[model samples]
Target chain A: MVANHELQRAEEWSGLRGFTNLLYKENRAWWGTRRWWINALLWTGMLGGLAAMVVFMLPTIAQATDDPAVAKAGGPIPFGLEMGRTVFFELGAMALAIGVIILCQDLIVDEKQTGLTEWLLAKPVTRRAYVLAKLVASALAVMILLVALPSLACYLLLSARVGSFFPFLPFLGGVGIMIVHTLFYLTLTLMLGTLFNSRPPILGIALGVLLGGNLLAGFLKPLLSVTPLLLGKVASLTAGSQPLPPELLLYPVIASVLWSVIFIVVAVVRFEKTEF
Target chain B: MNQTHDHVIRTDGLSKSFGDVQVLKSVNLAVPAHSIFGFLGPNGAGKTTLMKILLGLVRPTGGSGTIFGRDVVRESVAIRERIGYLPQQPRFVEYMTARENLTFAANFFFSGPQPKIRERCEEMLELVGLRDKADRPIKNFSGGEKQRLGIALAQVNYPDLLILDEPASALDPLGRQEVLEVMERLRKHTTVFYSTHILDDVQRVSDRVAILNRGRLLTSGPIEQILNGRDGVVYTLIVKEAPQGFSERLAGLSWVTHVSAPETAGASVWQIGVSDEAAAETALLRFVLEDQNVTVTEFSRKKYELEEIFMELVKGESDGRQS
Candidate 1:
């Protein structure tokens, strides 16, 4: 027998029995290894690098060429901080959503395909704990690396030129909306992981939701309020402090949060019914 | 449903199917605690499927199973808390070291001082002789090495019931010997439920045995009882000089059911089947000595080999199905 004092008896039988340990393992896969730094470089380079190029390169090119059109192309808003907000919120929203889908696409499907899920479920772990751990860990990684870090670096870069800090509350609101929008795809991809055995369906359906929703939203205006399609518009409007009606913003925010919770609930329920 | 306190695992009418194809028929098994129960079967006999059901990796379609009297489906986490399973093809995170894999599995049941967990991991590493390679990544380990690590990981929790699916299938003879030795040491502490095709190992380590064929259990009992000759009592005798009428006389006896004498190297090897073992024991040797020309060299009850019995059982089941 194993020594009594060396290991606890594990008396807890809740659905979240092994949640903390599994979450620690998933977090270690991100934070304990070089995966965190690698992701840091990738997202920061993609989002922050794009912001840097736009902030410094556009005005320098405009000045060197003496082209009034190039200067005007920076948009009607005062150039530095406003342009940064527009780029970070508008393009960053779409890029980070795709990035989250690609990064977390394999989280469930790969473990299932490789028999790791079978191995884990044989332990004291419940199916809910397994899916929930993947969701929490991946969501935190996406939020930190994909949304918050890049936004912070972009804030500093855009603020360096303006000689005044951007409004903290609006920037925070934009970041919060970006997190919810990306998490919609994160939970959707994870839910797909429990529903399907392969990675393609998970990737295709999740990316299709982001890309397909954006494309078809023009034809179906209702998708804007029901899905995450109009999230970027709301985020950009919030970050730029442009005034808009509450209904235009409130619907998508509530819908995204509701959709994320629904996806998580479906993932846990479906995974419980799944056989090894 | 038997709910016996002595049995570590019990299944009644456990069945499973994949789509329209049935993989496991109704299997009722009782594995007594602290006994090495060898689950034997031909390929596709549903041994692994049954193990999976007990482990809660696969849900049963037809029946109910319990470990420590908890329902397998409803109380799987509770069942898993006291059991350690090594799957047929043991898999781990490829990037983690052997020690890390062990530590990770250990944490599933254990939460305490970090040093104690590390110490337990080290003990398992040494138990499987993987101490030298503890720090190497799993991807770099060979097949046999990985199997050894798999054993260590399975035992790190010191589970009350250790379920192994072909635990020694990937090992060399020497490694197989070491694994058997470890199982022997653990037999007094835990009930070992393992499945394998190697009948020699089963005969060596297992006290109880069950054989399955084509999704149905053919037979199960103690190893000695299963090897005690399922047919009837038979005794073998080597006669160096036996006249032609000598064999006829023994065959004509009332207690002797049948007799066969085959010539080999100028000697007659006789297999005498008897209905009354006491009658044969008291009279047969005296009767053989009555023939002055017959010199009896060897006389002993025939001991059946496990392979022979397994083949006879499986072949009989197959033939019964075909017929």
Candidate 2:
């Protein structure tokens, strides 16, 4: 019996035993259904396909229209750079923020409300492992299908419109910025889901923070230093004629990462203290 | 940590309350290892709350508990690692099939090869008789099927202690019998600690039982001892053609506390309450045989059913509170 107990303990302590199973379950829920592919195609069309249309039509409108202001406004900036800027900063970031909130707002809330959290936590898995697995799995899915793939497709369409001189390094930095921004919302939504049992409160608070923070940062300049809105400037810094210095991006990146960590820590603590 | 410890679960002064509502009040329990211990209670009696406390799914407001000599609050993860729990309403991911659910549960404890995990899943499926419907989504399952799968998932790890909260509370008679059979088969491998309001099921399978009501433990002991009446002993006698004053004469004796003939038109069955079984056996039988006109047909000790004992204890406690 002692030997058997020791053997069981050894087996339980193995690499990612509980976390991997949870991850697999999460991935199966997302990828094993048709919802993932449909969402991916919908996002690609909305973000990438729209950027392509704008890029392809801008030159024609510049030549076809008699208005010199329209031609000049569309002329000075390279078409590829404008497309990258519009897709990365505006459409891509906004869609990802909203998409992540929609995807993650119910991740913990549904489980808790349906009594699945109690069932899962009754197993040998730790609370931290369970929360982390959901966060990690959802983050990976959103990053790959929602953010990275669409951003790449937008860049390719932009390149096809103009010459192949796409500013690759700066564009990569912008995508990284968008990713960090999306992580803020994802982690925040997950944290709120952990803190509350209902979906409306989590959704309202997370989305309110996303949209309200942007509007608040515009009026209050000091808020820009700490809020995730600084990530919005990544496209302007990368593509526009007057680009901000590269060092200016460090503060917001660090701040976003710090917020993500804080949200995750708070979530783990709240989840650990929760009773069923 | 002590393997030689006899009790698989031990709790002392285990109390819990949600704000002003006290659910469990100083519940001390010691469930012996390898025994099918029944936790009997009415609705809202804190049976599920106590099970959650033992499983460490809920914290105790005031008290401590230990499973296998491990602190419930501090070493709960270690405690849970060896125990299997089925909640009152067992909920699974409805999208997953029975096999997928069991495999997912097994992965938490066993970190072996894929084949080994699959083998374990197959074993649990067969154990619960879900092998035929292993691939069907659990959302399509019946209530009994879901409960059977819940049992299989609970025991997937081959735990030393299985805590099931009302394992057969929502099943039909046949379904309840199948679940009880599975639990009976599991007795050789693990100790089964289950809670239910069904006294008949407890009487049939459980070796020991604890009765809880209104957040307090009214009584707890072995089945035989509890059924034998904790206060005193009583023998039942079936006599025919008794004289008019026989029962009155027996009741007048010092050893015979009370006598009642339960049936009027039948074999004149009389339940004789006794203060001492040895004295009653030595004298009562001789006295009964000495009567010339009386024909004694059946005579034996009367055992109370669990339902009767539970009702008596609960009502006694209620009357005590009222007084």
Candidate 3:
């Protein structure tokens, strides 16, 4: 019923046509409803609550007990920093890698199965725009809910235990490192979503890369340099202000970023040639 | 735009194949502007495949097509910008409200003030008679309501061409009537090209129709021309009592090609196939009344139903293929 003259022409053409609209729809799915607050509570409770227990409850337990072995194990506040660094860098990274795989598993496959992809492509939307919008919006949501906010909370919890602020820049760098690592898995899952028709293969291959990749890296030493294998160790060391050679830190970060880009390119290319 | 044919949609020798199976043969069709063009075909008749090719949802294996003089393959995006599509089974985001779905579909074309967009969505809801259920989630809608929503979304862009695949195929009688009524009202604004197997619906609403059977275009033209019978004109006469020379009286004329008298319970009926309509209209009835013993109960030109023609065409094509 919209009058013909009242309509405004959309300026977007080939590659970027309908990109903003799709991005808005994807963003609304994350932030416009209860999804935002629910994810914030879930990730914060898991990551920040564990950090709080590490810095506060451990020393209290060591003081309350008279056993020497328990006392030695509890150690001091530096021990809490090490534990907090492990919580944020290692555990947080692994949890977020798994979280992104579970979160974005349906981003493409569900739409394909439900006939939404055919419906969407019938419009003026280009295949590139569709895949790019999904990649950008989902990455932002996953990083914000699973990485940024929870990492900030962990930072404050560790700083509070030390009776002063922790080094802000180093912690921020570690958060960036964790984001790159998580994006590697996020893009992998999204690419797998495009390649396969169902959720199992996407979940299987992405999760395998996260868990099995680490296990295999223990034997295949060269994989530590070329893959995202050493990213967690480098993030933990960097956040704890421990120094190492620059290549040890730089190589994994570069490798993870490169792999994420490759995954996105594959997703877009495969989706372009897709029929319906 | 200047065109070889003033058609909103034109396809030349369009064909599609999946593996070893050829679903669409060389189909040449032209749909005129601002008309309700009915695409009639039975199941597995390649109706949906051809629609998908025009929409760029499926790639054709051979030939080409154009919409508004733009190439269907090279300029598909630009062509799509001026058209709206509704699949046979319209699917929407189940959790989103009807209003949200309309707005989503509209945003693919128009991007301006949010209030203007909202106003357009509301107008489409009102047009489809879904104003009362605008805020309801699509998951709660019935089959008819979902179809109405599909129509609303397909019209949100005010497209110049609207392609609907089996719009009323799954609906009840009332729902089908409502869909046809909506199509009737939109004829002045846009060209509607819809595919269906329902002969009655096509006969009632379509000005132009194309019948497809077994991936081949059997016949296509204005509905009236198609109903006039392709072989020639035929006249019918019912006689109560007929002399033995009654058949010879009609067949003796040069214009009359064949005369067939079949038995009826109360009277005798004759089907007169004529080479010229004027000759039959003037002399055929008079020839029957000339006999004093014969009582002419009924005399008129035979009218063909769409169902009859569709059956004949399908049967002929099927028989032709078998032999």
Candidate 4:
């Protein structure tokens, strides 16, 4: 009886043991290849180079014009805040969202189509572990290369032009918002990959939701309360004069986190039911 | 788990279907421990499907199976821990080298001292004859090399049961021989359950065999027992000399069910199928000796090739289905 109990215990816990190995494999795939490095360099260069160009040209354009609004826009505080806002909203958020989608689009679909999922699942790993490892590794890659690195570069370049007046909290908050926004699409793309075995449908559905959500949020003002479009508004809130409203800041963060969790749960459930 | 049971794998009334199409129909199998079991079937014969069910890759629609006394579906991870599988078309990450792939597979089972894992990988690479090309990516491997690497990866953990689906189906004759040799070596440590369309490979390596066709099990047992025919009563009698009514007289015997006489190089060889061994031993020789016109040259039971038995069983099943 004791042996039987021990066997049962061992059997129950065995599936959870190999998750780290799966994570390691995923990490090697992302970091060891040249693809991740190239993408990272391109994204950082583009975002940093664009911010520098704006910082150098804004003052020149304001001095040449007789417009008071243009001159005010070139002021140090406004220029720094506006530059930070542009980096987060235009470059960071959109590029990270698209980057997450591209990185994870084939995470589960290619494995299933090639029968690698079947091979790996035949080991001591659980379905949950397999899905979680992919999510964790891909999320880390997006965070380091697309979100964290580019944000740092953009902040430095902006500070050089606007004279170090950027507050740490608002800039950090902006970066957090971009991460949350990216997670929404990353998890959604993973869920879609689990649901479908082909590249076209996964890409089509994820890209459609992303571009369509942005388009629809423009027309539907109420969606700002819940959708990721609220994330785009973070730049303005951080750039404003007053302290950040708790509800205004809390709503989109909470909504993005909730949607990410839901997408992850749906992906795990769908992957569990998938037949090789 | 019962340690006394000799069977490593057992299934009762196992069936699987995808939508309206049934892929396996009430398959009952018992694979003995530490024996090489050959699963033989033609194309679209549900061989791979049955293998998948056992490994828990695919679920069965009806019935149950057990490996090492654990339910297949409920305790799949436990079952998987003790078994290694080589899929029909084995796929690995093409970007990773053979050594890296093996290391990745080994990591799932062994969390070890780094040196121990590296040593095991090197051993497996040498065993599969891929030691020189261990660092080369799998995309650079030939088909035979890839198949060999698949075998090494499957057996890396030294599993209790090694299930290989078509291990050498895509290999050349020399490559097939090498894969079979590896399997034969592994037989001492594990029960090898491999499915293949190659009968000669099965005959050369398998101690037990099972035949499946059209999603149904036709026959299964020891290789010798199956090759000896179900009834164990078949004899080949060779006679030389001139006798006009020799075959007619032999066919008239009550114990003979089938008699075919084909003249080979002026010698008539008659394959006599008998129903009773006692009758054949007591009266068969005397009956043939009674005919003074024909001189008996050779008299022995006919041995069957695996191909012959497989064809007979498959054709018999097809005929039964049509009728």
Candidate 5:
């Protein structure tokens, strides 16, 4: 005859064992699939690209920093400051173009293409939550890419160029500008990626918007030349030797913001309406 | 998310259409709690559409329903919170391990404790028989294995309602059997509402069935009830060859009601609707033994396949959709 106490203890032990077994099962999936390695490599390459670009630019920066002042007389800004500013502005513009385009490309496009779109959507999580998770994951991945590569290259280049890279505040400011431009581009690209399912079309549209905005700002600059107050419309772009008019600069920024918001809305709507 | 009502699912005057072609008509259906409910329809039938509407993934042109007692549209979140959906083709993050994928899914559903989430993932993996492969990346997984992984992910939150849309259709015979076995095991914890045109599967697992065609449910009830209907019983008699007036003689018998000559190659089959099982058996034996030319090939009760039953009910529904 078995004692009641012994029977109860045996039951409890089995229950605990059952739970332990369950935990082991959930952890098992990590070993069964090979797709995660590719994703890791993709992120690594993405960040590596930015770092490589910055490293490649080191010689041009060193040359520019070494050259004497180009102005004849009564210069408003120092020669070194002017050259640094030129490099910074060019870097900023290019970063904006690349970042927005890259960021706009969504993780969902592959999901949609691979027919996994229907499967994931059928799960318990809402579309809003799904979209939010992808955004957070992609954003974090991009942040790692942006900070690891560009900032590292800049820090190393400055250390090599100057004895101590003193006055790090201005350098930090330039990086901060890059960060904002990257965020704007990322947000813009994410929207475009979600709005369209194809990669080529999304890339095409993203590049078109980036270049078209700058070109349109240039063509419209003369229209506003009579009224310099419209300089705001061209604040973020450069045409020929002139920087964007502050008034006209607002147009591109607002346009980018609007596009980002609208594309996200489309993604959410499309996701909702889709059968999956 | 919502209070459990008498009916777990309710739809009234539901209809769906793609342009001029209507897939569903004014159909009404209700699934009871704690029972296996099967939705049976052919490939182009509106079963998937109906399930999507219930999930709020697809917008129906007309009609409405309450899933898990929550409005399928306005209260989709509440409904979704209590339901686990496994699609026909489940897609997971290819870069994440099965465990990592489950963890990612758990973040959205479980808000309690981190350890509990891990524990829940473990439980789900075990349920789907993927405990050994929990760390595997999805890209390396087989089609059947991925589907099992999909089910594990779906059960992360321990949902009360498990909605599977043709979860086994993609699998080969062994895979299909494996999936159905898992589904059988899952019934203890959740109410399984699955849609599939595979009659054998439905007949094996479902407590009740809803057969739909042309976007409208032709019949919805217990599988036995729908199958039994008002017909008595069909007796299928296969002879070595058809003798002249064989059909006429079977029809003339007092015990036989409705006689049908079904399509078959090697044998001449005569289906006779019998009034009483014992009497039909006696008479069938007597008639076959009395006839000298009769070489009995096969004789048994002709049970209706679910496909045949579904076709019989929804055969004319599409003609209405054509207009």
Candidate 6:
């Protein structure tokens, strides 16, 4: 019985050994990687801003709710503050977009310029693992900062403004939307990096896409007057004044999927054919 | 056979053309299980192209290759799962310490299991002789240390096959020794396919070598057999007193093609191309004692260095085949 057990243990040890070996073989190598501290420092900054914003706003939100006046209030501004609602969506959205691009830039373009791709290709790591780890890490960082931090900010700010309030459902919904949008954008950024394989070109491509997409939507708005295919149907959602038509509301989702799919295909294809 | 290593990579008639120039011309080579095979070549010899093809990084213009017997062009995942590669120039995230850099790398491979990784990371750091420098940032590391870390990372999981292209080219002598020593140690468990113009390195470590020149393999075999040929005769004869007519007598002798003067005064050395080296050895011994030398001290066979033979054969073959 002891002999059998020893044999089993030895077998299991070999199996573990094999797994660790595979982890090295199939895993993305860190050789030729861009500065890890840069990514770490960048992540800390984004999350730090969110933490500070939440900490600063939470007490004020609690005090406002205790007064009962703001809690029971209803007005065009949501409270009596001037030019306040713009601060919520406008600043938040812009911050989210900027943060997402910054994080993705390091993950994709910076790594390429540092010659990590050649090193990575020499290893046994699959293209899927390499790109996905990058996308996931950066996207997760974007989500934590863009979605989670902002969610906390909104909750504290909203609770303080309205008093005696929990905005859990709305916060979750916003975060969910932000995550989906970020993934879509992340996918686009990855494709651009793979296509260009250089810094200035990758940055130019990513910047062109984000800014160009919005500009394209604006340009397509006039065309929408003549045709249903135009951005007229989707661009109108930017107002946030009226409830969305189900199809029109799905526009971002659809566009996100479309772009993501295109990027996924391009990355997979480019990955297979490239020589180290 | 173990699944990960079974048929990991394969290729056939693999060729590549960078526009009008043909870089890899129908090149063929194979890596067996657990052997240090040196990809010997000069610059622009397409060894790099062959390696890239194995890695599935570049699309070949023609032909194919295999890593672990699997189709290199099609089943790269198979090849990838059992291999670790260190390119000629290895770059790391400069700002992060070796530890942090390794941790971030571990995440992509491990995905979870934090405790195990910490232990393994320490162990790997030790293996590459960088345990004490774990906390030191990679940017501050000298070229040797960074390269040591590079080798550590390459072997972290103890891959079955480690593909290192010119692993010691950028290193100083000490740095080169460190890398080569680590590779030597790793050879016990892993198969290393190292490419380099450094023939001494290949001579010191490689069991076998494949010489590539002008995008084609000039010759490939065990270093010993290939270097001196199977039966090529080499001799080192030391005499107590030298003869004035030693060169004249040795020169026109049958089966003796080349001769060189000795660094020592009373030493006579000659390399003869004889069909049977044993027969030539007997004949040379008789000729030396009977002909001229007053007394012989060290009369031993010459051991050819791989570097000299390699340069001669490959360069000669390429030059011979060029026009």
Residue B26, model 1, lDDT? 92
Best by lDDT: 3
Looking at candidate 6 chain B, the ten consecutive residues that score lowest on lDDT are: B3-12
lDDT of 1 by residue, B148-184 (tens): 7877888888888999999887789987888888889
Ranking by TM-score: 3, 1, 2, 4, 6, 5
Clashing residue pairs, backbone N/CA/C < 3 A, model 1: none
Q: How far is A106's C-alpha from truth in model 2 (Å)?
A: 1.0
Every prediction: chain A TM-score: 0.92, 0.88, 0.94, 0.88, 0.57, 0.64
Residues B218-298, model 3: lDDT tens digits: 999999878877756888889896788889878889999888989888888998888988877887777767778889888
Which DockQ value does candidate 2 get?
0.47
Model 2 lDDT tens row, B1-54: 354278898888999999999999999899989999999999999999998888
lDDT of 5 by residue, B1-323 (tens): 33347679889888778889887777799888888899998888888888888887777788888876678888775677678888878877666789988876665454435666677778778878888998976788998998888888777766788889898999998888888998888887778899998889999999899988767688898887676643657777888777778778878888788888865786778778877778887777678667788788788877777767877777656666577
Cα-based TM-score, every candidate? 0.92, 0.91, 0.93, 0.90, 0.72, 0.73
* Global lDDT scores for all candidate models: 0.85, 0.83, 0.87, 0.83, 0.65, 0.63
Q: lDDT tens string, model 4, A45-85?
A: 87776766666766566556676665576564465447555
- Candidate order by DockQ, decreasing, is 3, 1, 2, 4, 6, 5
Candidate 1 per-residue lDDT over residues A211-274, each given as its tens digit: 8887898898888888888888789788777787987888999999999999999999999888
lDDT, candidate 5, at B60: 75
Q: Return the DockQ of model 5.
A: 0.18
Off by over 4 Å in 3: A60-75, B1-5, B240-258, B263-268, B274-294
Model 1 ranges off by over 4 Å: A11-13, A59-80, B1-3, B240-269, B272-294
Q: DockQ: which candidate is best? A: 3
Name the lDDT value of residue B227 in candidate 2. 91
Candidates arranged by lDDT, highest first: 3, 1, 2, 4, 5, 6
Tens digit of per-residue lDDT, candidate 6, span B10-46: 3456788889999877876655666788888889898
